[model samples]
Target: MESSSNFTPFLLFLSATLTVLSSVSANSEGDALYALKRSFSDPDNVLQSWDPTLVSPCTWFHVTCNQNNRVTRLDLGNSNLSGHLVPELEKLEHLQYLELYKNNIQGVIPPELGNLKNLVSLDLYNNNISGIIPPSLGNLKNLVFLRLNDNRLTGPIPKELVGPPNLKVVDVSNNDLCGTIPTTGPFEHIPLNNFENNPRLEGPELLGLVPYATNCS
Candidate 1:
């Protein structure tokens, strides 16, 4: 009987430990997002609700959480936000959709974003963002929609971006990108016009065909 009573205490201790760990994870996500908030110039106070002291970032506006209280979506599209993105965003392990389109954000896409394995959609279209498309983005196996149009981005579209299994929509048009468009994996189905408007971009690569100016200057 005494052994069984001791097992009860152990169960209670384990439960408390788990609760503490859960709180830590939640706080970490909040801290990462707050860091980004400090970096941006929000003209409309869209991020006013992002108070870190709350129980979890799940309560913050423009943020969405899963049933497990982990951040999964960050929808801040068209809020007129300007400022460079922060690599701290990579800490949102459960993040899926990161939408910040139609803003004036300027900077290179963070290579650290490649660590977001659960990412689904990465939309940054109609912005002034510039810099090479990070090859690290290819690591997001679940990525689907990739919109980076109307930006000043330069360099070859990373061949890695074409390999994500779930990629269905790719819009890098109207950018300064060069090099041959990929023609394999999910790339085979992406429309040709999506590659248009960029004067330096070369021919749409077919299977085994050489890419247009693979090495962009």
Candidate 2:
């Protein structure tokens, strides 16, 4: 009878251990989502519905998760969110789509965003962000679509972004940028509209014109 009593406590210990392990796994997912939530300062409470108490981000609005319960899509475009882009977003290892266009976010593009190796589409256009494009963004090897138009970003276009192998669409117009646009690879195929309004920018063909030739010289 005494031996049975000892075995009962052993079983209880095993059950408790399993429970703790399960809780840890659950909290880890919550922690990642929570970190992303905390990065943005939602002034109009657009993201107030993103509560940690929710069992999974999959059930949350505007957040799509894969079968494994990992967040893969974050589409919050035109949600009126106003804040700076946070480097903490790199924690979403499985994120594939991130859309936050038509907002008021303002700041330098965080180089750490390159850590999202699985990212395929990133759209942050029509914002107030101001900064030079980070060369580290060239590391998004899987990026297919990237848009950052109508912003306050300044400086020369990073040459590294000219011809990323997987890149198909890139828009960086209406910004305060300058320099001779690269004439190789993707740059050669992009239309004049893509680099318009940046008065200092000179394309290969444009450089031969009398007006452009004088400025470029």
Question: What is candidate 1's TM-score against the reference?
Answer: 0.95
The TM-score that candidate 2 achieves is 0.77
RMSD of each: 1.3, 6.3
Could you tell me which 10 consecutive residues in candidate 1 have the lowest summed lDDT? 206-215
As a whole number from 0 to 100, the lDDT of residue 152 in candidate 2 is 89
Worst 10 residues of 2 by lDDT: 208-217
* lDDT of candidate 1 over 151-187, digit per residue (tens): 9999998889877999999999999999888887888
Q: Score every model by TM-score.
A: 0.95, 0.77
lDDT of 2 by residue, 1-217 (tens): 9999999999999999977765565456566667766877787777777778866666767888786677788898998877788776776777899899998888888888888888999898999999888877788888888898988887777777764677777788888776666655566666668777766666654543433223432
**Model 1 ranges with Cα > 4 A deviation:** none
